[model samples]
Target: MDISLKNGYEELGVAWRRGCEFLGTDYAIMGGAMSWVSERHLVAAISNAGGFGVIACGAMTSDLLDAEITATRELTQKPFGVNLITMHPELDQLVNICLSHKVGHVVLAGGVPSKETIRRIKEGGAKAICFAPILALAKKLVRTGADALVIEGMEAGGHVGPVSTSVLAQEILPYITEVPVFVAGGIGRGEAISTYLRMGASGCQVGTRFVCAFESIAHPDFKKSFIRANARDAVTTVQVDPQFPVIPVRALNNEGGKKFIETQHNVIARYRAGEMDLATAQLEIEHFWAGALRRAVIDGDVEFGSVMAGQSVGMVKSEQSTADIIQELVAQAASAFSDHEVIRSNP
Candidate 1:
């Protein structure tokens, strides 16, 4: 569990491009944004450790989001980003909050970033980072003024695109013209990050791994659940069928999730009868999540909640500080770059 800097890949650093600069950092990693979990403490902690951290915007009012931004500024003078769900009605106000606080970057998640929205972000002096499901979408987002791209795969948590990270990365990387790509989904260990770095990704946006970090605010049960999870522990299921389109999310399968499927029918039936609202349905969906995470992370209910983890969870066996994790990941990347096997094997 110990990664001694002396015995590992020396001169570890990640080269990346964001906005107008090709920047290099001690580590090419980001603490992925998790709903109701990411805050100033966690974001700042990761950024201070030489990795990017994104604050999650699950259900924050303008005032509270502003406060969180201010607190993050107070915590670290280093760079960080704010993750905003595009479907949220108050998206503009939240974007402004980040601008006013001088947050250098804003990561738009859950949906596409519109041209107007990207224009507004530019006007506010913040760089836009948007997620794309495919190469076409990635190109479109770059045209819309996205400073960079977060290409997510089907293995991601919450609302996600149908494509797997492998397909998405392969389809998009070479085709996209300018903006740098940050791969999201199913990343859990130093070796995985190293693999992606070799795959033309600028860095890895890691949400689930950060959830298990000591500083995350998710119920202790949630963190502990991740502690014991292997790759097979997580699965994605359908809760509500959207008539427009459907996307699958990866999560831990448990009794609570099974109960949720049964409840989804009753709830959707009420919605169809015009007796329930979208907000109510959303609450019910998260209710299942809270209960499940409560069981897995809190009550030692590994078989109890819908724990969301990436496929690489099998590679993790112990928890370490954010700094230690970054160091190890970057060291691995450096080793991979220097290793002669790939060179010698090539004709």
Candidate 2:
């Protein structure tokens, strides 16, 4: 281990990998890609604070995505990545733009990324990252040339997998032959990051933490909900089977959640009448969220919008700059490490 104790102090650069630049900091951590919520300014803020920030591509057009990449470059010369949902109609175009920008990395979320897509990303000299819910998928992604993997436990907001992060990270880390593992989902504080790192993760990729950052574009109301939330407030809705497939995601157990259930029944009714196809209905599910999220995050309608949040929302207290949040989190993680060592060394 390259543990340095220079100047009677602990610098994050000394403890973490200090080679690559993301935003203006070293390559020790990354902010996860969040949809409809992660935009240019917030992404740049995370990068500026020394962590790699990935721009989410859910609501942008191909041309808009290109513009965002260009805008991000103007914000900071530090390295960053772009996220592309594999199932989108414009996935190819979005991927091409990221390649053209020479993005430091590319995170492919949504469905399982194709082998061809992974190959293209690697060929363009960019590291390919993907989310794998289970061990089998993680192995397959590694074989398909994934440079890294994000294992999202059920506690994550917006389309989390079924397994817990504890179980999934432990299951996948040891067997991975090439790709480095990152634990996401429900990680909001300094202590949580340390806890996961000790579990064999190379680093942590945080999402919900960034959501509350002052720079985040999520509506003010949304941030307030985050501040008010505790672990008990975050809950996953009952499986809303859309007759196609449903990825159970965690969120606040609010009126929006109940409405989603009623909406699903409507979808089932509409499906029988041939008014909607599975794809449209699925998109509708996502669409329903946008208005509410926009209202909640931007308009201040906390109760109406689908306030997608992880279990760690309870830990978040206030809106701070991205750098302050990052620095605080790192400090917390270091503290945990020190305390753990003291306990183990005693007696």
Candidate 3:
């Protein structure tokens, strides 16, 4: 690398060095844990490429998670974390599995984790990382002994909050300084990562961009859907009736998405007619997409499965190696500084 570029890279490193140290990775960039897609192969690949990888323990049983951690360990000696859904039936057992494997970091995602969950993770000697959608929750997580925080905005794929990434960063980044805060949602480029780091974020998390990584086990059809999508193509699920209260999920619009709207309407109608109680109606609506993500990701059901993707899906052009993807992001971030140095010297 040229001295100017080297300097630029070093500057970028300095900005996210806290994240690097916390994650024990070469770069502060974290691979977003997309269930069914972020398995052992992709997780290990991201870590091996100098970025932190996280296993998505979404709905995985204790034995399943145990085997996955072991498989990922065989692939990469680098540090990686496991993401556990707070709503999982066996959350405690999953945590135990991670601790047994001596995982360095544990990301508690899906919803606000209980203080006891955070305490247990820390007590097991692994750092606890939680997602804070808003400023108030960010502070609460910190007080609850969260070692790190990831502020994910609505633009992110899968389940999301209402705010945009930029807005969330501004709201939570400044207030939560006790621990490292990683920014997520719609972050596809290195420039965005650099911008967040400059804004006092310790690092950034990316998911949609990694779906097309060569190491990802997602169906080819799934990757093609991402490649063919524009920002507008990736949209959040719409609720036909506000009373039923469907959680907003950002995903590529498809037949399944359209069906989801119809399903919500049907469920609401049945509830209004007294065919079922409100709880049963809501349960039916939620169950509609239960296995939808896995269908699209693993079984090539792009037309009907939930193809979750962020607004950054538009930025993914082609399938590339995990290392190449990380390198591109790093290069893009470093170039900003290099360009500035070149201008300064010539002037």
Candidate 4:
């Protein structure tokens, strides 16, 4: 590498080195744990490429998650984390499974985790990472022994909050400095990553950008949908009735999403007529997309299955090797520093 490029890379590294140290990876970048898409292959590839990879333990049995951790270890010696949904029935068993494998980090997502849960992860010798959509939750998580925080905005794929990434960063990053905070949602390029690092974010998490990685097992049709999408095409699922409250999930607008809206309407009507109770109606709405993500990712049913993607999906034009993707992001971040050096010298 040229001397200037080396300096640029060094400068970029200085900004996120704290995150790198926390994650034990060469780069501070984290591969967002997307259900179905973030399995062993993609996870290992991202870790091997110097970015931290996290396995999405979505709806997986304890036995399945155990096997996945074992398999991912075979492909890479680098560190990775596992994302466990907070509401998993076997949450304790899953935590034990990860600890038994000596997993270094465990991310508790979906909803707020109990303080005891955080303590268990820490006592088990793994760092606990939690998702904080707002500043209050971020502080509380930190107080409860969260080792790190990921503030994901509404632009992310899958279930998301109401705030945008930029707004959340502004609202939380300045106030929370007790632990490493990673920004996610709508982050596509290294330029954006660099911007966040400058704003005191320890690192950034990227999901939609990695969905089309060459190592990704996402079906060809699923990858193609991402390639052809525009930012506007990725919209959040709608909730017809506030009483039946549906957690908004961002994905490519498809028949599945439309069906979800219709499903909500039907379920809410039945509840209004006293045909089913509120809990049953809510479950019906939630179960509509239970197997939909897997259908698109594994079965290539892009037309009707859930095509979860962040607005950053528009930036993913084609499939690239995991290593190349990481390299491109690094170069883009380094170039920002190089440009600063050039301007300073000329001035």
Tens-place lDDT digits, model 3, residues 1-347: 68999989988988889999999999999999999999999999999999999999999999999999999999999999999999999999999999989999999998889989999989999999999988888888899999999999888999998999999988888888999999999999998988898899999999999999999999999999999999999999998877778888999999999899888888888899999998899899989998999999999999999999999999999999999999999999888867766888899
Per-residue alpha-carbon lDDT of candidate 2 for residues 241-264, written as tens digits (9 for 90 to 100): 735465666777788888878877
lDDT (0-100) at residue 78 of candidate 4? Answer: 99
lDDT of 3 at 286: 82
lDDT of 1 by residue, 1-347 (tens): 23333322442343343311422344557677875667888888888888887888767889999988888889887788899989889998988888888777888987887898889887988888888887777888888888888888877665666678888888887777487788888876666665666667777877776776666666666666666777777777664666312245577666766776777777777877998787786566556555453455445565555566666665556666767766666666666555534455575
State each candidate's clash count: 6, 6, 0, 0
347, model 1: CA deviation in Å?
Answer: 6.7
Estimate the overall C-alpha local distance difference test score of candidate 1.
Answer: 0.71
Kindly list the per-residue Cα lDDT of model 4 for residues 1-347, writing each as its tens digit. 77777888988989999999999999999999999989999999999999999999999999999999999999999999999999999999999999999999999999999999999999999999999988998999999999999999898999988989999999999999999999999999999998899899999999999999999999999999999999999999898888878788899999888878888888888899999998999899888998899999999999889999999999999999999999999899888877776778899
Candidate 3: which stretches are off by over 4 Å?
340-347
What local lDDT score does residue 52 receive in model 1, on the 0 to 100 scale? 83
> Each model's C-alpha lDDT?
0.71, 0.77, 0.93, 0.94
TM-score (all chains, Cα) for each model: 0.83, 0.87, 0.97, 0.96
Q: What is the lDDT of residue 105 in candidate 2?
A: 88
Would you list the rank order by TM-score, best first?
Answer: 3, 4, 2, 1
In candidate 4, the residue pairs with backbone N, CA or C atoms under 3 Å apart (3 or more residues apart, or in different chains) clash, namely none
